[model samples]
Target: MSRRARVLPGFSLSLGVAVLTLSLVVLLPLSALFFRTAELGWARFTQVVTSGWVAAAVRFTLGASLAAATLDVFIGLLIAWVLGRYTFPFARVLDAVIDLPFALPTAVTGIALSTLYADNGWIGGALADLGFRYPWPAWRGFDHGGWPIAWTVYDRIALAPLGVVLAMCFVGLPFVVRTLQPVIEDLSRDVEESAATLGAGRFRIFRSIVLPELAPALLTGFALALARGLGEYGSVIFISGNLPATEIASQVIVKMIEVNETGNYADATAVAVLLLGASFALLLVINLIQRAAVRRGAPG
Candidate 1:
């Protein structure tokens, strides 16, 4: 067929727009980071990024992000499966609500999480009745070993690194769920039915037939969630109590700039450059994986 349809502008025009958008939205800020960081000599940059506090923050940030992203993979797979494969009352509503974290402002999310998990809050109070609590002080106690314990579901998660993981899980959940939903929906039940007919148990069928197909999407979602978790700030600051001990890498940068009278912006940029490099590495790998997945006719 001669002169088949073209829905959009010519390639040159489209490419120009894409480059402009990318430069303004992403490249310019990143360039500023490097430029500012260059002001700090290599020795100074290394000292700032490799300091004891910065090291600790980096370790905790990576650890918490990994833990939260791993948890999200399991939880998201289960939810996406249910939402995509089943019909139930308010199913659509539940599906819609899965993205609530994305739609809500991070500050609002911070406030909500802090309130819900506070000692006197609903979940916290119920957990208290069940003997789960955090030891706060002489106030809000249940007479345990002469120490005053406050109501919290976790033994020590409230205002700790574990709380960072919790906040990350909340904000990053939608990525995993949304990523896997399409894959779940596209899954052919015929293979599963045949496996069942061939005497495969539910678990066996799922493990052998479904998991492999979902694995790629799971990885992509995990990477995405991990990236978001690493960069998280507002919600995590609230849930994690902003303790110096529980500070993440982003907080380290913030403190470096804001904590001092002189405000070490160059030092902070040095640390940020490292983080940005790492996050970009992760995203690059994810993009390659996504492209490979698409080539293999798999849902992303």
Candidate 2:
């Protein structure tokens, strides 16, 4: 039997440092939140969660985040393709621009989008010429009928739902592109060439080969974007009109703590816990899908 060597490097030391960092930075804060929330009895916590407005807000937040993440996935893929495949002039400029949302303050993004989508705003005027009306209710402060129904796309596209989505796409496009860009660049073009030689169409080659390879990364990007949009507050608040049932997950938690006297810290903590649970569940599902994809990719 071979004797164990003592020459191994500082793996234990590095791991200890990492654990300490995570505990101080992440676990401690999260534990505090849960501990504070525990002060709310189960009945109160249940009431906070099951409240009609809270329910609606949850639905809207999840729905908008999902829609935004989905849209980001496609646009991000396109951008990634352009960045990786085509070398147009100013490509580097475009590359840098994609990361702007990441660096820009969320409040700044909210203000900018609110201004752009306002009734008399420049972009809003053009869209209005195309027959767009404000989508939110008047109480929400956005002029209703801002965009015509055609521009609405989905039935719920109006309201802050769509605005939140737009903001999310702006912030999230980079993650998707960055995740998939390397994979796309390293992909073997010979597969496409060989498939084309076999009389397969471009769409067929992409459907059969490209998409499968991209699926894992696509799911990863989707998860990241969805998580981000779920937690997004500043960029969505102004554009979303801050209406009840239209506000996002994080916004609801903040409002409960800040606005309503009846809202206890426990209630705020409960809602946050719910959001965290949802995010955790989503990540688990995405990871499972990724693992399945990897298994499928393995040689039989």
Candidate 3:
């Protein structure tokens, strides 16, 4: 038999291109972050990372990201299930529309969300009328109107921590929905039918069988959403008001360089290094859990 010509580059050429691309696009920029941090020396780097403002920003960013990812798991799964299993008018359009966030500019998303959630905006006005006003004073650690902690927390929905969560959810929704949709579509109906035939209730089957099968995909989606939320800036910036020691996000580290009185870049990069390390560690744990779930669900 005659040998057929290859349609693509050989392994050596392909590997070279891959490495070059990775170096240019990912490695070099990430290395710059570390290089800048190293210039600060150990003491200065630690001080920057341990600053009160940085701590507050870290807390707000991580808290909002976790909350948004948790919500996305439930909401995304429901949406994916409906789209994957049901037939309805404009269902395809709805599915496509879930990706609007991915396509829309982040600045535009920020502006729109800020407009919708601002005190004088349509949605914001109705929410404020319903007594959902943000507790600005409480956010600054003052007792406003003797409000309870719970109510104060609830009131901080717009231009506060909750606003950051909302923006995170808006940006992260597509990740969860897109991840889960395929896994949901690939699920075997026969397995569900067999469970039903065995007298298993809908909830029972869902909890016992469906959930286990979907766990890995769900975890993957959660990781993606959480990562996206953690790094989010533009959308969150507008809605959160970026108040220092209140609703500031981790991404504000970059802004620190721009706005710092001494024009120090090292402080910003030190914060970036810390954020990167924490994010990588968390992602590693999540990925391990996902892999374990996948292995557990696999047939021996």
**TM-score per candidate, in order?**
0.86, 0.87, 0.90
The C-alpha stretches of model 1 lying farther than 4 A from their native spots are 128-154, 284-300
Q: lDDT by residue for model 2 over 1-300, one digit each (tens)?
A: 996766755779878999999999999989998888778878888898878677768877887788889998999999998998888999999998888888999999988987887656677657766775444321221235443222223233224466677887777778898898998888889988999999999899989999999999999999999888777888888887776646777887888788766665678899998888888899899999999998999897
Candidate no. 1 TM-score = 0.86
Give the per-residue lDDT of model 1 (tens digit) for 19-78: 999999999999998999998888988898878788768877887888899999999999
Query: For residues 1-300, what per-residue lDDT tens digits would candidate 3 score against the true structure?
Result: 997788888879989999999999999999999997899899998888777678768766787788899999999999999999999999989998999999999889989988988878888878888887443222233234443333344453566677777889999999999999998999999989999999999999999989999998899899999989888887877777767634554556767866857766778788878878877988899999988888877889
Best by TM-score: 3
Instruction: Report residue 51 deviation for candidate 1 (angstroms).
Output: 0.5
Q: Report the error of model 2 at residue 224, Å.
A: 0.7
Cα deviation of 141 in candidate 3 (Å)?
Answer: 12
RMSD (Cα, Å) for all candidates, in order, is 7.0, 5.6, 3.7
In model 3, the runs with Cα more than 4 Å from the true position are 1-5, 133-151, 154-156, 260-262
Q: Residue 273 deviation, candidate 2, in Å? A: 0.6
- The 0-to-1 C-alpha lDDT of every candidate, in the order given, reads 0.83, 0.80, 0.82
Q: After superposition, how far is residue 228 of candidate 3 from its true place, in Å?
A: 0.7
The pairs that clash in candidate 3 are none
Candidate achieving higher lDDT, 1 or 3: 1
Task: Identify the candidate with maximal lDDT.
Answer: 1
